[model samples]
Target: MQKDEQRNIILAIVLSLAILLGFNFLTAPSEEELAAQRAAFEAEQAQLAEDANSGDPSTPQLDSTLSAIENAAAGLTAPLDRSEALDQTPRIAIRTPKLEGSISLRGGRIDDLTLSTFFETIQTDSPNITLLSPVGSLAPYYAEFGWISSDSSIAVPDSKTVWSSTVDTLTPSQPVTLFWENGSGLRFEREISVDENFLFSVKQRVINNGSSATELAPYSLISRTGTPELLGFYILHEGPIGVLDNSLVEVDYDDLQDEKLIQNRTTGGWLGITDQYWLTALIPDQEQSVQTRFVYTGKGNTTRYQTDYFYDPVAVSAGETVTFDSNVFLGAKEVTLIDDYQEELNITDFDLAVDFGWFYYITKPMFFALHWITGVVGNVGVAILILTLAIKIPLFPLANKSYASMAKMRKLTPKMTALRERFGDDKQKLNQEMMNLYRQEKVNPAAGCLPILIQIPIFFSLYKVLFVTLEMRQAPFFGWIQDLSAPDPTSIINGFGLLPWDVPELGILGFINLGVWPILMGLSMFLQQRLNPQPTDPVQAKVFMLMPFFFTFLLATFPAGLVIYWTWNNLLSIIQQALIMKKAGVPLGRQPDEA
Candidate 1:
């Protein structure tokens, strides 16, 4: 009888897993896939805008030339290919160990940049991820530093201004100084210096050698043309973000478009447009008071997301030189790199560029833990495992106490069952007696749930770490899990490729992926649940029994690394709970052993 009951329990768990796996086949689409759908929709919208504005006006422009550029987007602002537009622009080469691109000499714009370390795909030979593109490119994104003079006659550098440079290339050790002089005798020189990584120090100086003193405010702007389709996930912020006067601020592109503009005047902060993995931020003088804006301008088919800042006006006397120094950050949001810059350069909250969501406290610490372990272990997957263990250490005492309470409840079940039978239909009396029993035994039935609830944030924070940061983008694990940031590619329906039949792309129903790691995860979850006595209430027991199976299937299509972590977490939890159960002398079975 004992063996049969065990077999039945085993069979039930297996059946649940199978049913859940089938349900997974009908699961929802992933964010990346949804993003593609949104892209298509946006493309259609762009076509409609072009048709509607074929001869219409109301499209605002910065100047008449900007209006001409937008109107002649066919051959100017909106080019089909980025390379074509880039080739047409006169650019000074920018080369660094980590980054390679060009500064467009036409507008003195840092527009063409590609991260040498990051690739579009896992394939080693794949093209590098393009960070900044020229103004006429598909998604025009670039940063430019200029003078915003209170006096309009000073002839501050414009987009059409052709700056002359002495150097052919801007390197880490070699700085490039571009000089452009107005016929009015005022000369502007910008000396640009880049670090080994992404930080670019632009020191702009104005020399009033010809005439009277002029008042000028140094300004920097990062502008992106066309609303690049965002991930659209509320938890993940992908748009304008800044730290103004020690307070962190973030704004969505669509939100800015709807509201028109968001302006804030503060002492100092860094502001920029951030994507899921890539970012381009304009960092102003850390100590100077400045006004920043997350502004949007939509005209016809052209929409621009611009994050700009202008320092308070500085007066430059005749024969005097006024210098303004600021930094521009353009690269992948690597945790260590950003945090290092934040600490070393004294840039306020630079690491916040990677969206850690509302629970940044938990998320950042968790990422740091994982990052530290990755350095030691040399594998992000194993690093994640160590991080999981590290997080569990702090909650050990709480979990131990909770488990002890559960064990005590397990021992008192018989008396409770007898009391239930005695009470019969007397509901109020039964409740009072149960409360009295609970008080006397010093047992809280809800105690065990607290530990489970705590894991929610830890799990969510880990999810955020895996989702947004490029550090883990193509991080690999053991067999079948190449990218920690991507879903498992292997599926059970195809017999793991043993059978020749192809499985359909199950969009959101990715749980149908049913990879090897998910199967192990399901098993670990089952074993964890078995560490405790089953609930006496049939409905509760059934729900508890099926949860592991449901989650196993549901998470199968998730990032393989997360599933691996989940499985490891469940296994650790099972061991922990079992040790606690034994230490507290809790009965393994529902009924106490009968001799």
Candidate 2:
């Protein structure tokens, strides 16, 4: 027993040391080799360019074919845009064409504005405001402020002051102010600021010099590319409780590769907004007092409008100043940090609680706790190891009892074999006798499976953490393993320059390559299983032994972090099993001695 325990401890230490060394080796790259590789790639690209320009018919044709394939692939993956208004029948314009308010600001004729024309006008020199359009191509176009208004009657003292065709220099630090005076002796002033680094703000100040103290409900009309149809705009809210994107809830997935956007709407409640391609608005609300409406117009000759109303609106009192602030995020979904911020803009029928439910109530807090501990350790890999140890320690007593129960079962195996032989054709009677014997001995037949059952959830949760958590994304372990979020680094066949299969030419390898991690993972699984007690049922044991191979195939396409976690788990399990067996006074042999 002492010898077995000592052996288990030694094995555990050795395995841990080996994993650390492997990680170190994977992260460090030889500077000379990297420099040489970069130079070679540059030279190859230059050569390819020169060849393509040499008027070689075959080369040009090949390039065209490749380009077409790439475009087709991109089109397949890109989301469909739903902001065009051309699909629906035209309705009467909601606002009046002519201005009749206390303050007369610039107004325009609806007929003179084509989507293209409006976009063009903004493209001209405008410093205060910009116009963005979604036409000609998918790329976004920015337009500067211009002198012309929809109503040509309103003239500014200086056209140059009204608009500048250059990029707006107004930043969050210093804002631009606009003042307008109408025939009714009403004056309107607003401050606006926008910066390259996502900062947009607007403040409106209205003053009524008229003796009647005329009341005016203020509204501004600004054209944007991806506005929601119903409210003629989108609303995004941020608050201390949580962020709401058009009010939609967020979800997490075990495998991002398996994720698909599934739309579900609830009846008799806010259906919440769904964005086909682009998100349009962000609003910050501190209290239930905020009320806003979002209207969207679809793109491309189809004029469809959708409206959303927020009843519990955050309000601004008359003659009282209130500030609405929120950070707006726009970009790709795969970029998680940015996307998380953008998610606040989505609207959903149901409110999302920070704690998802009892499940989240438990898991999220635990996740944070584990995250803190791991982060303090400096290396996430080491943190994971420590977490694994922490989990295993709590299960030690249960696992130890299970092992003892299994030892008793092992002692009875010879007697069971004799009984089986005696009742070769009387299986029912043999089973009844075996049950009676187990009851008399106070042994639970399922005891051997307990440890495995108990460990499954922890194992799966670890898998989720390693694969889905942002912490592991692009994290480094050791030499060659530059990105834990990707497959291990390895050549197709040692010296083969080409990978075994064709993959998109991105990243360092130019193809999806499975590195040494999966291979090591499989080996560890096999070793752990070999060291475990053989099942009394030979067929079951054989099936169990094949699991390592199955896992190897499944893991080949998974992130390296997952493979590393599983490999370490198996190594630890082997150590635990050895210790358990030692405590049971069991010898390392194919079969146990009869009781």
Candidate 3:
């Protein structure tokens, strides 16, 4: 009977600790923290606008050019292109024979006709025009530019131009001169500087030798026509500072139900399209300011447009040369490289949160400050360890107080047990007696639960910080954990590729391919629980042990960062509990009440 009673006491202590750990792990943020974060974001945006407008040279030019472009677009008629005709067969189709290569130029507009495809990287080596179009099994078609015409009717000429490495020999910063004489006695001669960076700036001098002011409307427009499915996802942005259209749709083969585009409107930002595997950002030069509009063409010839104002329209006089220059950024979403360029592009917003309370506000700043520091530390895993230790040390006093409360409660458990036996089945009388006894001893039954309640939110807020924030998306932790956003790299049922447990292939189960880390996490949790106090009741002991297994299964598909945080937290709890036990003069094997 004594052994059974001792076992129950231990089990109760362990259960209390487990409950505290779980709660603390989940509640790191309060409502006030969230409100503060929102306020901070708004203030930052206001400051950015003020700085951008102060001593700004691009404003006047941008306002003027935007007016001109809008006026010109309003007056223009649809071109007689083959694709525009309702009766004509789809004869004109854009083909991308090669989807890879670089272009010449650092920062300037190039005529769309000069390039083979729209999706080309700008690099010093292999400085030739390349475009991105679905040729073999890919979807959607979009083009980048070295030069674009202001006149929309001038269709891009379809010509087989062999752009080879020989052209790469030409210095990107060098000048290229071109002369053309049409049958109409109109001579077009221009000398443009091709920067060593692969961008070209052209000053077009059109000599209308044939009398009267030429009434030709000059503009540039990129056109596309194809089955909607053939174009997986298409998004067009007018400039760096623009709002995307919400009507953009994602083509899903299985469901045939289109996915809606999520639009965000705030300060200037980049455009990202997942199905296209492409991201484009506008890089504006001081000489030419730019704004952006997002265009989405959906199935059944439906079109959606959202415009953001940046600059005014530009006009060129007849018999005179006018210059318009802007930079274009075309590439994949490489987080580190993209961030480096984003600073140069004057982009400031990058998501990185730590928690959702005062701690979150404090931690968010630290995360940003330590970003470069953490990156240099060789591994993000080590960075997390350092950050955890830094936080825990400061809160050590509170933690110690909570532990002391629990030790005091453990000392009074024997008297409580005696009261239970003395008034067996007399619930009302037993409660009165227990309360009187607690009062006499100056003990509070709830004191032990306070530390746990306080820490629960902090733990949860940290989980949110590590999981949802974009800063940690592609961050590398330790070996094999290449991307913190993804699950750890370990699979149990390998080779045959069979689904585990014969569960239905849907929802969460369908997505979880790796299950090794979760198992290890469960094992660690079980060990941690074993090291703490055990429950006396068989049912309660079973519940305590089974929790680790339940958590392991629940976390099987979570991001590696989340798992790392939980595992470390459990380890810390074990250490803290051991320290408290030693300080209270409780022997490892002896019952606390007996002492």
Candidate 4:
């Protein structure tokens, strides 16, 4: 009977597979059709560009393409290469141990910078990760500091204003001081200082040279010319984020665009725009009060997102000078760096910039523990293994108890089967007998679920750590496993990148890019399942059998580090279950059912 039951289950699986394959075969698009669509789209874009250039209002209206949308968000009629845009502006060199770039002197903008330690790809010769670019660039993003005043008589330096720099390069020891006179009796001085890492100190000082006193409000702004490409997942926040009065506030770009503007008044706090891995923030003086605002200017495809703050107005009389001090943060979101800055600068809740998700309590600890382990072991992959063992050690006692109970339940399955047969149509009687049997045998069927329930939060927290932390960016794990925060580069298709051709990361089909780690995870889960007794219900058995396969596909696109954890965890569970089941003396075999 058991053999027959197995055969029937196998047949059902085969039928399901056949149906799935048939659907794929029917829906797959042909090469000709794909090429035709691409050609038509390109032709339409060319015509639109031609019409716009010729000033033809009668041109056919067209919906926006992704590139078009990005350009529109940037307030650019057309996208220009970033290098070209940066070349148009005069710049002062900025050099540090961890960063290399030139700050634009024309707008006094730190808009051309890249991380010295990070790269665009795994290749050693790849370019560094560009953090900011000039305004005329394809996707212009920058940070600027100046004064905003209600009084029109006072002239303040703006985006078009040109400043003369005393120094050629800004470094940790040498700061660049810029001078700009509005020709309206005001002499403006900006002294820009940078640390070896990513923090910039900008001191804005104004001297009222004219006879009348001037009231000007000092302000700092970090603006992204276009709506950036977002990860668009709920787990990650990629837009305007800030700490207002000790409270963390995060709003998506779409939300800000819809709401138009959000404002708050606080004595002091930090505000900024955060990408998945990078950040650009304006840190105001903690001792002084300021007005903060997150604003979005939406005009067609060209839009702008600005996170800005204004310090209380300063009244400077003739021959008197007032200074406004602030910090500009632009670089990779390194935890240790941010923590140091927070401590040194006393920025309130600055570390909250990294979205630890709702499970911050768990995720933060998980990251710190892993980070510590990595420091000790010197390899992130080995550290993950050690961390998994550390976590399992504490839960060992609970897991042992759960497995012992599961083994006992397997041993009692024979008696339970007999009760089911005896009570054929009497479901109530069968349940009663099963309960009495469980009580007598001291077997708790729910015991096995406790460990799994406890693991849910742990899994989510670890997943969050792997997904968002900069410490894990480009972290290597043995061969072919570079960049733990990214999806596995190798795929089952194309001979794991050995083939000359590439696979299309199509919408739903992207899930099929299973790597070596995810496959091992699926196999480990299957072996682990064998330690437990098969369910009496056929439907339940099928679910248990298919769970590993379902998870294999589902997690293929997740970060490689997260998938490695699951694989390692499954192997550990299998070993632990084996030991517990053997200790319980639960005989392993095909236990027969009553007929």
Candidate 5:
């Protein structure tokens, strides 16, 4: 019977694979068909872009003046190469230990910046990761700071205004001060300072030297032209995000497209656009109330996403100077650095920018634990192993109880089978006898589920840590696992690199290409299942038997670190369960039905 069951399970899997492979082969496109599909896809994309550019009738339109200002601010004209865009404007070199870039002087925009420590790829000579780019670039992303006035005649520094800088280069010790006179007795001074890290402080000061007093409001914005490719996972937010009125506001790019504009009023909060590992946020004065907005605009193939804050208008008396202090964060979202900035800079909920997900409580502690372990052990992979052991230790007593219960239930299988035979063809009587048996033996059939239930949150939290945290990005494990945050690069289709040919892209069926680590994980899961009591029903037993194979394919696309954790966790569970079952005098290998 056992051999027959094993044969049935293997046959089912082989048949499933055969059907999938046959379908894939039958549906495969020829060269001409592929070219035609590509052309159709291109045309569809162009039409979508045209539809986006064509304004929606229901969506409110901005006035011509504001529209012009936005278009100019975003440099929504014809796109140019990044190099050409950077050369078109005069810039002050930004020199720091961790950053290498320049600040454009024409618009006083903090653009054209790159991370000195990070690269576009793992290759040796890859270019640095460019965080900000100037206007006219294919994808313009930048931060701009200045003042706005209700008085139409009042001239304020804008995107077209050219300001003189006090220094040719900006460094940690040397700040750059930009000066711009409106030719109307108003002198605007912007002092920009940076630290050794990602934080930048910008002090906007205006001197009212005119005969009449005027009111000016300071505004700062971070804008990106063109929609960026998103990770598209619901677990992490990757578009417009902010903390407003002490509440976190996350709006997806598509959501903003439908809503058009989102407005809120807050005191001392931050607003910005975020990617998986990087962020660009504007921090307004904590003591002052400001109106914040997340806006979206589309033109031709170009789209603009912006997050900005407008401080309450301040009246500057004649001969009096008013200063507004704010800050902009542009760089990698380092967990420790972000936490420190939150504490030191008094930014509210700044750590939320890291997207710890709903399990922030569990996920954050897990990350800190793993981070600390890595610091001591000097390898993130080793840290993961140690952290898993530590977690197991704390849950040891509960798991032991669950395993003991399962062992006792397995030992009572003989009595259960007799009860089923005695109550043959009577489902109700069989259930009654099973309940009475459980009561007499003082063994709970559901107790074995406790360990699995507990693991649900732990599993989700660890998955969140692996998916959202920047520290795990590009982190290396032993062997071919150079990026813990990415999927395993080696596939069985390529004989795990034994063959020179690469795996062909199979669209939705790409998960069929199993990696070495995932296969090991699936095997461990299967072995671990052998020690547990099998389901009595044949159909359920078959489904349970297939779970390992199902998970192997499901988790192939997950981060390598997560797959390693699961594999190690399954092995540990196997060892622990084996010992517990042996101590309980429960047979380890034989199924109750087979016995």
Candidate 6:
């Protein structure tokens, strides 16, 4: 009977693993689905090429040529390299503390930009992160603000129109004014000013000197050519995102492609496309009613994704001037900076762009705490350590009670063993005896699990903070941990880099490349487990003993920062449990006598 029960337990564990693996296999995209996606992408590309050559009336071309503007409405006839595209048009240089790029004079667009403070890699001379490329470049991404006129006879600034700039370069303290005039009595002037950070203040003024009242709407758009690469994680949102009507809206690139367009009318909000760590959004006037849209279009050999907004058309009377005030955010998604902008600019839920996950209440404050610690200590790794201690202090009373209960149970292990031996064959009687014993001893066997349960949400929140927040990216710790956001680099396969050769890539069995931090985490977990009460059943005890090893392999692929946190948290638990055991008069070295 015991052998049969053990076999059932083994079978149950096997079946559970099978179900998990089978679920993943069933949910994953099949080869046929991948092939179909490729075919669809190719078809889209072909249609775009055809539309470009056929002069599709719906396309929004950005070329300055009159024929191109009248025919194609999106972009250039052929794609050019970034440098070549920038050289094709005159530009006003933009120099800031954190950004270096140029504003395209041809379309009066903030097109070419690179994050001066961020690099593509951690190497000393790695290239800076390129944020926006020119319209004719391979991956054209840019922001443009202008006026749109409903009257067919009215001439407004199109992509083809070149505007003259008042300044040679745009800086923080110095603002640049761009001027353009229509042959009919209308003048457009855009004053662009940038702060030390990522915000761009755009004040667009339009004057009507004509002998008639003309109506026009102020509009701004952020356009990106081609679908950007995504991290492919469900936890992070990458694509078009906006806050409209006090609600956040996120649209995936694939979903947008299928839907084609998503439109909303809100009195105050912001709309834009977002990458994993970077953002480019348009903030329309907070008090004015605006029509916002997240649009995807395939034109020419490339596909373009755009988020734009247009204010209601205002009638500009003869000899009267009208102005529109708006802003653009283009740069890294820093936590504090985004929060500050959310309050200062009164942009609703602007901080949601950072992907703080479902536990925003916990995750945001956790990030702020870690950020504060990191600022003071100058090391994020150390900040994690400090934060762990800070978290432990508040939960001390609960943990102490749990440990005391575990200590009592540990002392009763011998009595449990005797009960099992006497009623070993009668499972029903054994359970009843165990309950009576627990009642007589004034001990709750389930008490030890409380600490583990409490750790679940805290664990997930910290994971979210380390995974999504930009502040945790590329943060260095001591001894070969250069990027806490990435998995540990020192794998056991290469003796933690003592040997020169490295392990070959293992797709599904990646945990085989166990790292030093994970091993330490497992060790710490084992020590903590030693302090807890042991299971009376032989099979259960063995399974419980193997849990630490199992979790070590399971979490080997997580970020190093998280592994460090777990290791530190386990060590703290071990110390707390040991102290509680001492106070309860339970021997720390006592082991359960299964015999």
Tell me, by TM-score, which candidate is best: 6
Per-structure clash totals for the candidates: 5, 66, 60, 3, 0, 4
Candidate with more favorable, higher TM-score: 1 or 5: 5
Least lDDT summed over 10 consecutive residues: which range in candidate 5? 53-62
lDDT of 1 by residue, 117-140 (tens): 889898868999898887555566
Give me the overall lDDT of model 5. Answer: 0.79
Error of 3 at 507 (Å): 7.2
List the candidates' TM-scores in order.
0.86, 0.53, 0.54, 0.86, 0.88, 0.90
Model 2 score (lDDT): 0.39
- As for lDDT, the candidate ahead, 4 or 5, is 5
lDDT of each: 0.75, 0.39, 0.41, 0.75, 0.79, 0.81
Candidate 3 per-residue lDDT, tens place, 1-595, comes to 2223334444544554464344333332333544554564455334423332111001111222342211011111322221222121111111123223222221111212223332233223534432222111112123222222344442211111112121222234344544444334344444444332222343434455544333232221221212222221111111112222322222222221132222233334333222122333333333333444333333322221111223333333445443334333333333444445546555433111011233556545544533555767866666766666666777778766765655555555676667767885787887688668767866555554444454455545544445434456456776667666566655555522344554333333422444656776788788666544444345766776687776676665566776776677666766786678678864445465332
Q: Estimate, for each residue in 356-385, the C-alpha lDDT of model 4 and write its tens digit.
A: 877788899999999999999888878888
Residues 212-249 of candidate 2 have per-residue lDDT tens digits of 43332322122222222221111111111213334444
Clashing pairs in 4: 72-301, 72-302, 73-301
How does model 3 fare in lDDT? 0.41
lDDT score of residue 337 within candidate 5: 95
Q: When superposed on Cα atoms, how far off is each prediction in RMSD?
A: 6.1, 16.7, 13.5, 7.6, 6.2, 4.9
